[model samples]
Target: MSEQTGKQMSKEEKDARFEAELLPVLDPLYNFAYRLTLDEDDANDLVQETYLKAYRFFDYFEQGTNAKAWLFRILKNSFINEFRKKSKQPAKVDYSEVEGYYNTEDVEGESGVATTTDMRTESVQDLIGDEVASALNALPVDFRTVIILCDLEGFTYEEMAKILDIPIGTVRSRLHRARNSLKEKLEKYAKSMGYNGE
Candidate 1:
């Protein structure tokens, strides 16, 4: 039913529908949020914001449809909006950088390359997790979102297109490039970590 044409739901009805439909997707929502934010507090805030918007616009939501996908779309949009706003703010200096600089100056000469023991002998699998995550995180937002939606969230290409509001062909091409880029990144680490493509 079209949102404006349907008989308006009562507050209790809306609450019941939300609980029955949207609440069950909470974990998936948080996982998506956490992957995007990489911070527990920020993920929580993103999920909360998504739910608030979902609830506020629940009437427009079609019942018996893919609720999880619906919630994901909301969360994805919210994340993008939050990210844009955060990007507009002045950048902050992380304390970790300051500490690292001091430690580097004390241990190694200020001008020369800092020499350290090489762990290149480590197995690719041991190092690939962090490497893969970094590569995934390094992706552009549009590419990253498609990867997350398709590979991570197990959405079909059609579903990903819908969630991303892009054409299906666009989704196909973006995912292809994203995977190729991620593979190149992982292969670089694999070679460094002593993997010989076996």
Candidate 2:
């Protein structure tokens, strides 16, 4: 049914449908938001904003469709909008935090390294996981998003195209380049860790 027809749904029915279809994907939505924002508060705000928009325009959603993809599209758009809005503003700094850090005895010379316990060799799996995450996060937003959507989320190219609002061919090319960029990053780390692909 079209949105106009769907709008005729009773409020209770609408609420029930939303609860069943959308609420189940909350964890995945939050994961995506966290990856994009890399900040818990921002991710929570993004998810909240996405849900608000989705509920407000729930009429536009077609039942018996991929609700996850619909929600993801809304979230991706919200993130992009928020990013653009923030980009236009001057950056904010917390002088108190900087001052407190500098006042601490742990402060070393010009190098910003802290004298914390070494975590590099604590756990092999955790180190690898952290390296992978760092490599993924280092990618540009467009590249990082394609990797998250296709590789991490397991969305088909068609679904990713729809979620990203790009042509299918563009999705393919972007995914290719993103993977290559990620590979290069991981390879550098691997070499540093003495794994020369031998």
Candidate 3:
């Protein structure tokens, strides 16, 4: 790879750093995706698409820069684009009934136990994690995004602005509003748990 001097680099060297550096950020990418989409399948697909796009455009990436931030920008853009495109489409028809018909023999195999997992395994909010997650999930996507970027990812306002493609002032404003909204949500949860706002 180039020596951070904006010099030319060989493809092998680029590939080496691309894998070495970018792969480490995959967990954070997936976590960010999950927080954005709130669906495991969607998050997984978003992460996959981000990686593919990033790899295809690796030549444009500067060496010795903040790879995580770069990767995050790509992921956030991908999520927005993909989700927006999906929102514009009509609802899809699921074919689970036909699939289930074919799986009947497997479902009835051996002990014939019911395959469905019990939702009661986890209480609403599950005391803390679920409560916090539900509150976060309830937030508007824009506010949830600021929380994930600024608070969760620990990005500075300037860094967040660059990643989010917004002005630093806008980043600060959004972060303020988002935090306030999240606090209100958590306060409700705390009240439910007898916290009394202490």
Best candidate, lDDT-wise? Answer: 2
Runs with alpha carbons beyond 4 Å of true place in candidate 1: 1-6, 92-127
Put the candidates in TM-score order, highest first.
2, 3, 1
RMSD, every candidate, angstroms: 6.6, 6.8, 10.3
Candidate 3 to truth, TM: 0.75
Candidate 1: tens digits of C-alpha lDDT, residues 79-98? 77775576454563333345
The prediction achieving the highest TM-score against the true structure is 2
lDDT of 3 by residue, 1-198 (tens): 335555655678777988998999998889999988777888888889999999878878887888899999998998887765774544522223333343344433331222222234655445467656766776787888898887788988888998999999998899899889778767644554446786
Give the alpha-carbon lDDT of every model.
0.75, 0.80, 0.75
**What would you estimate as the lDDT of candidate 1?**
0.75
Q: Where does the lowest 10-residue lDDT sum fall in candidate 1?
A: 110-119
List TM-scores for all candidates, in order.
Answer: 0.75, 0.80, 0.75
List candidate 2 stretches off by more than 4 Å.
1-7, 86-121
Scanning candidate 2 in windows of ten residues, the lowest lDDT window is 109-118
Model 3: per-residue Cα lDDT at residue 43: 88
Tens-place lDDT digits, model 2, residues 1-198:
335464388878889999999999999999999888767887898999999999999888999899999999999999987754764534533333443454353223422222112345466677678868867876777888999998788999999999999999999999999999888777766655556778
What clash count goes with each model?
0, 0, 1
